[model samples]
Target chain A: MVRFEDISTPARLAEPGEGIGRDELSLATRNHGLPLEALRYDLTPPGLHYVLTHYDIPYAEDGDWELTLGGHVERPLRLDMDELRSYAAVTTRVTMECAGNGRALLSPRPVSQPWLVEAVGTADWTGVPLRALLAEAGVRDGAVDAVFTGADHGIERGVEQDYQRALPIETATGDAPEILVAYAMNGAPLPPQHGRPLRLVVPGWYGMAHVKWLRDITVAAESFTGFQQATAYRLRQEPDEPGEPVARIAPRALMVPPGFPDFMSRARVVRPGDHTLEGRAWSGHAPVTAVDVSTDDGHTWNPAALEASDDHRWAWRRWHFTWTAAIGTRVLCARATDAEGRTQPLEQPWNRGGFANNLVQRVPVHCTGL
Target chain B: MVRFEDISTPARLAEPGEGIGRDELSLATRNHGLPLEALRYDLTPPGLHYVLTHYDIPYAEDGDWELTLGGHVERPLRLDMDELRSYAAVTTRVTMECAGNGRALLSPRPVSQPWLVEAVGTADWTGVPLRALLAEAGVRDGAVDAVFTGADHGIERGVEQDYQRALPIETATGDAPEILVAYAMNGAPLPPQHGRPLRLVVPGWYGMAHVKWLRDITVAAESFTGFQQATAYRLRQEPDEPGEPVARIAPRALMVPPGFPDFMSRARVVRPGDHTLEGRAWSGHAPVTAVDVSTDDGHTWNPAALEASDDHRWAWRRWHFTWTAAIGTRVLCARATDAEGRTQPLEQPWNRGGFANNLVQRVPVHCTGL
Candidate 1:
């Protein structure tokens, strides 16, 4: 007997205190979440699709924001939006999710936003390759890390500071020209809500790696440890557990399971009969090679028809399963395995911050007798 | 040093299997998820907001869809959308979250939708009260529960069935008029994506209690043991643990801490200085009575001023605290207490399915030397 009231504490919204009013509270909620309804595709979700900015949106005036490349470089250089735009531009569809995308889903709720699955969205980012910008600065030897800084700064917790993060020198130059100092998204100038003027788009990495409102690039001999680097975005096992900073996304499969309304949290009313269950899959480490759909509660698994993706290393693929649903309750589960055989598990390894929770997704459905 | 590879399996999007081509994959991804930037908020996130339907959306013809009230009642009544609309209409604001809103946040993530915190949203639903309609149906004695049946159905896990949930006869009648068979949302007919024509909104309860595209109301002599009622949505300890079904929201306080976009996930660059921090707090058990602010990682706490709310039992209150910040890294934390003397814990008891994950939210900030 699962008593409904046994849930103990059934608080609804984190109600507003006297500090804010209904209107203000409304604004705050909107400011933080990219609605689930915005979800469209499984691949290339769309640039303006979803974003997780660390600070309030900063508006830049013409010639105001500048990207200054300094540190252990032979020729330190500073470039504005227009100047950076003059360089060769490349466009790529990248999937970006917040490092804390599942923070709220954690049992104890990690110290981050209470993000739902909606924290993810895909976008086509156009920008100057980071390697090119670094190359123009003539990087000197002994630089171990490339530190990226954003213009949005504020008091987080209690410390007043600027936002900064870092990537290893190898990663900065490896897929030369893939990491971007982007100025445009979806063929339009970067929206202020997104980092305008310039932002870093680390294809396949979590959103935090893509520093917004880019302003400085420091080629340092040591790793960078600013606000976001040293403390936030790290995947801890315990509260005090010193863990790795969250980065690239984990491979996972998401389908518009019959009744689910795209990315919205609301379930759709599914019907009894045969249905084409389909969705997109992607991976950062390796290409998605196989997808398995389980309609009988993982009892018997069947391989879903797969789609070959483009040559783009970061592009996603589509998969489908023809489900002859019966008149009853069902849990339609989808699982994917990358080329490296890194398959999604029934349960994701639990980390402190709930980062990259890419377990198999179980979508519940009910078919009417009618 | 947490290496980027430390994330172990850095897979990106759920890629398609080796079947379809890039073009087809593109079409599939676009088939779901709304574009992220399209999010708009009223009290609720909207029809496309945080809805989770059970079966394929059932289309009801103007003359076909009907609401039948029977079982244990004296005079069974049948009404169409038009007839139901003729009853006295009432409207109210309600914040609804999926019972599995924080599903993905769970450790060893549950076998369900990999939801983040965005699985919640508020809405103003207008409809005829359930009790009023029940009265017209004339409930007879010996009725212990009202089993609400939705037209949606399907196979869940392995069980074939329709979607049905029950409400104690008392609650159905006690919260008279508040529980409505809603037809209009934000002043429009319910969108098909959101249970077109008819749906139930049980205020203060999780989204599961709000049946959508409703069809039948059966007054029963005992509790219902449907799949969702006895099996799914329950908080189990071990995999085989018989857990209770999750219900009601818990007491929670969340502030739009600096660095996080005012209402967006985009990081807001905060400057070094003293700033007033505020946000909303609420509890389903009782009204929020007090809130405490902690700046030094929970070392000390200070009382925050609370705003008195009118007698809207389900509404939340806003609260605020002031802090003088220095240029450095910091953590901002807020804990809330309800009028029942139930204060939030620094650590909430961990539960399966990650239900009621209402621990305090900590926001990090960084102040530069500048």
Candidate 2:
């Protein structure tokens, strides 16, 4: 049994030369990433999309579930699934990415969910707008933040509580991004792993802000400082430093490996010929404006054609390039630049939590006879 | 670039005290196991079901796909999706477990997919029977085996080829244990991760026998030797020995951890009181007859109530046990017995490939105040 003090110790990076442990492997087996090749689909199939669950997927029956809107509200309300679904609904395509998407790639990696660039996926979510519900509840005077709590309860870093994260009052009541209380994914009811009855979908923010298995929303008069927000998803180099809270995703572009993979090594093998390279690029801050592909590592690059960004602005944009291959082994890389002029970096700054590290992706390929 | 000779090196057990490599971690991120808590549902959700893809999920268009049946068949034929769907279809709920489900738990674990139980799920698969398709093609006399090939192509152990596996002709054409040319899962068209257009589902066999993205069927007059059949999925202790091929899944039982889990260690914590333990048990060899639960780490055992097994005989059966908890740390274990009197072993013998290791499960729980 872990002692109480040991459980409360702050998160730390893996020791130098340390490898992924059994604990991290256990978490990896439970959570999955979008297979890099799945980028071919515009709206990733539900099962193929990435998933990251902090605790057990709470077993819930829709008929017995209820969402309570209380705490510093004009009028407290509790609504069942049917009542919640009665509101006017809208469907929107959004790309969601975990805050720790590239955690394992960091030097002296954070020993949590060991992700390596596959932690992003786009989907069409259907639900009632969360701002509509907040307007109906009437956020009382002096409300500073809104806390959304999921039914999934567990102990994290010694504190035992329901999983939760809070959004600033203006963001919660904002009209532009269109926050949603989603109940369906792609066209079907949310699967157990995606949270059954209801979940919060915060567009343009990291996945931590999009709480799943949502059961309660409390409008608070003070800034909400939950363990997830204050302790876990922070960008800090030292344990004692209070770092910036992670939010919007950084711009990143990932390609479908050009050729077949070696089953054990995953090294690509492509015959010498002409090939069409396609991929998806996205950013939570703004629409993507440009994508660049590199055949000789990052030494030289060529611009790729970007798709029109008028539709699905909050989702990924398709990009493509044509390449003529020669007989040799080479490294392929892709980088994206958003409308706000934020381009992916060749190297990402390291942090204790390893949140939002969008280092460029490099795929090794062998150009030889198949 | 990987040397050709290095690519041909056989898979070996991890060096003593060595950790999981980046290659294995990359594979784990792409594939996933069912979260143990999902055992509560009778029909596991599509997204929560465990998936293992040896190679990439081949891109397929149903309208463009055609299944060819030839080789030793007296009447070689090709059928498109519409024609294949016109035949009589049957839906069956089968519990499928990976042959390497408990691989990581073995000492000196094999350096492949590092699975630790949880690599099992039950789903309702719908499609036309393979025997019917075989009858339509009319197998010729002296046919010894049938080879099924998938569209996923890759290099494994220095051999570049489309993934292929073969089954004895008698088993492929058998009346009992019906095999399916499946095209749907859980009432929906096959998801890309599960195989897009078509797949093979062999009831009462480990998942290795179920080929995904199936495209071709060839009947042979001699026993077929393929890499997946003769090399990878064998139970041998020596590198050069050709051991028994892994076919049927051994009896096994896994319980949903009784209480909430620690986010990192996954150690269960429950308030000191009476608690009910629930789990699922299955065996591909025969129907599971009894399940025994032990709170003292297999030292003392108590019988659990088993649900009716007449329906969904090929699927898992639910079992439950009530335990009164005391404030302390305890180990929980569950073991299953099949109708053929085959019970799970307390410890599994080590093998080079780490296939078919179904020892009893041990869950560590802290029965203290939450």
- DockQ leader: 2
Q: For model 1, report DockQ.
A: 0.04
What's the lDDT for all of these models?
0.65, 0.89
- Interface DockQ of candidate 2: 0.66
Candidate 1 lDDT = 0.65
Top of the candidates by TM-score: 2
Question: In candidate 1, what are the lDDT values of residues B213-299, reduced to their tens digit?
Answer: 889999998887887787766776665777887777777666655533322223333456777777666676777899899998777
lDDT for each residue of candidate 2 in A246-346, tens digit (9 for 90 to 100): 98989999999988877887778888899888899999898899999999998999999998865887899999999888888888999999989999888
Instruction: Determine the C-alpha RMSD for candidate 2 after optimal superposition of all C-alphas.
Output: 1.3
Q: Give TM-scores of the second chain, every candidate.
A: 0.80, 0.98
